[model samples]
Target chain A: MKETSLQNGLVERYIREVGRRLPQKQRDDVETELRSLILDALEARGDAVVDETPEEAQVAVLKELGAPEEVAGRYAAAPRYVIGPRLYDAYVRVVGIVLGAVALALVISTVINLFQTQPEGISILVTVGEFILQYISAAASALGFTTIIFVVLERTLSEEDLKDLKDETEWDPRTLPHVEDHDRIQPVGMVVNICLTILAIVLFNLFVDRLGIVFMQTEEGWRTIPMLSETALKTYLPLWNISWVMALALNIAVLQQRRWSTATRILELGVKVFTIYVLARMLAGPVPWLPFSSWAGDGMQIVESLLTQVFRWAMVFGIIGTVVEIGQSIYRMIRQR
Target chain B: MDEIINNLILELRRGTLMLSVLSQLRERQYGYSLKERLAEQGMDIDQGTLYPLLRRLEKQGLLSSEWDVSEARPRRYYVLSASGQEVLAAMITEWQQLVKVMEHLLPQA
Candidate 1:
């Protein structure tokens, strides 16, 4: 009787291990069927004798059936990989492009800082080390974020959407963009836009100190004057971050769909309006330029005034450009309808 | 060379394994009884592979199963569905044509 109980305990443990991995809907049925099958196999092996089946015989039968995980894996409904074959190509391309953009941005920022600081000897090496560390962290996070987007896409994209992506027979030449079609999403342009937007986000959020006009000064060597007043930047950084992130998300959506739709165009219109509001507020708020009078004495007074003029003109042009973009978006949306 | 041939053989058999399992389910059979029946006919399959495949086939609507509790221990019996019979018939016709094609294509042993 004790031996029989021991044999049943071994079988019960194995069943539990497999059932724990199976989906809830199938777990009970699979466990019941598996128990019956195991007992049947044991009987065939002459180990199901009422009170005498040895524990070793039970183990042997279970081993032949295979490991619990392997058995459960065969029963899994979902594919094992986070990003399956359907989205694999897009995932790889997006990660490569984003990581490349991040590395490029880091190198550009480091070069700009190097020129501004005129770092000598050990300082130059320290700057390069910092650049390397920043690139590693940026690239890692970019890969992670891109993977998460693809994982979400893998789960959410319907079969029809995937088929549209891959099936060459489904292609219709009539659907191709005309020569003057402004709504046709240019892949190369989208990539460049995404890269630039990401670079802006990284620079504004992380390396705001490096945004400045570099000037040569006699006797004092290279003088780095930090542009953009600290109070203004601190007030507006969150808004800028939100706008850039929204732009990044919109660009990714267009890239995935391979063309601009009415929905995305409407989204673009909304984003541009938000951006205009932020720019208008910044212009109306305190002067964003950092004047050099306190640090540079009376000799640099003219340079400070020239910098102020340049900053105001740049803001004016930025607002004008965004307004023109918003007009284009509305035109496209109306025409597309 | 032997390993390569073994793999090639395995690949060839993998497709036909589903047909072989389906053909036997014209009548109802419990899991072990079905496994033993196939083994008797010289088509030995692992319990691990056969059992999950049975569940998958049922999920695909090719087979229907029921639990018979009248026995000493309950056994789940699987039989061919109506659509399963249609698929089996079509598959048999395709297999026969494939066999004829192979016979003509291959040099006489």
Candidate 2:
């Protein structure tokens, strides 16, 4: 009897610990159920004599029962979320779409500036385009950020109502499903598509007109006709034009295939650095040897300076955005593991 | 194996816990004593799990508890509220029907 009492006491303490984490309303029922389970487990062991030392029995019972935290976690419902699983996934999807759209818009406006004949007009266009791109990107990011806040709030509120629901639903361990190996192809495919589209646009602008595609011009420099200006096409061009696309694509592909291997990540960083260098070169073009001649000859010097400044700022922002996205992807990969 | 037994036990608990708890509270009993009594009936309940259920039922106005300081060990005694009694009656009826259905399916010894 003394041995039984000791075993019972250990069981009681175990139950109490598990109960403390549970909501106040469902505490009693869950406690009762868990206590019965402990008793059942003890009975099944069947090793101890009735008169054995209580402490010894308790030690035996507890060892067999497993850790209190692990057992309690088993009984807990799938963890309540502020945003439900469905909503969280939806939120991520919507945010991705919004960012993609904003990027596309910025790319389109940049391409338009490249085509304008009037130097003064080009300067104004670049400034206006830069302002619009900044505003839209900020708005989209803010919208995405709000989804996280909403998820947190929803979880807190729902937890209150769900406290009493403990015994109604059977506890099942929640496990994230294994991500298939094939899923690695998605980011790689997106990167490749983006890069190819950009290259195609640049090549089309550069070679298409000389080859007789009327709207495209390659004579002085690669430029596209204003009428052919579409947001998707423009955004695709400047975005994929830089070396970052190759680096980002390779990194994402390697990261996906190899998980968090240090060598792959280092290579990714190298590619990013090289891409930045290329971007800087594109932003800061060759300095004019004869500024006065160019300024007086066609009055295009002022226009060129303004366009260069706008492009420089855009490239700087693009680099910042790319770095941020890379950092986020790396963090996500680690966390997902 | 233990896994199968645990799953079966968990399912049984999910279906009948509310009724078992409600029936026990028809008479006034404090949390600790109620748990002890249930254990004697081979339904050992952990205090960790029980306290929360009691509070929830109380919040829902299904059960009422009051601090009883009559004994040296002053404790809170809980009794079934009218609404709780009604719910318990409904749950008991549903359980009886379920038992009857299962009994019909089982072969007699």
Report the C-alpha lDDT of model 1 over A127-194, residue by residue, as the tens digit: 65788799999999989988888888877888888877875776789999867877678899889999
Best by DockQ: 1
Each model's lDDT comes to 0.83, 0.61
Provide the lowest-lDDT 10-residue window in model 2 chain B.
B67-76
For model 2, residues A1-337, the per-residue Cα lDDT tens digits are 3324644476678778877866677577667655544454454444545765655665675665566666555455535445675456656777777677666776566556544532333464466566577867676676757676656645554654656533576666675577564224455665576567566655655753333223445778765333222443344445445444565466466646745454565566666766666555545543212243322466676665665555555775767676776786577557656
Interface RMSD of each: 0.6, 8.7
The residue ranges of model 2 lying beyond 4 angstroms of the native Cα positions read: A1-298, A313-337, B1-8, B11-15, B97-109
**Candidate 2 chain A minimal-lDDT segment of 10 residues:** A286-295
Model 1, CA-based lDDT: 0.83
Q: What is the TM-score of each predicted model, taking all chains together? A: 0.58, 0.42
lDDT score for residue B90 of model 2: 93
- Candidate 2, DockQ score (0 to 1): 0.07
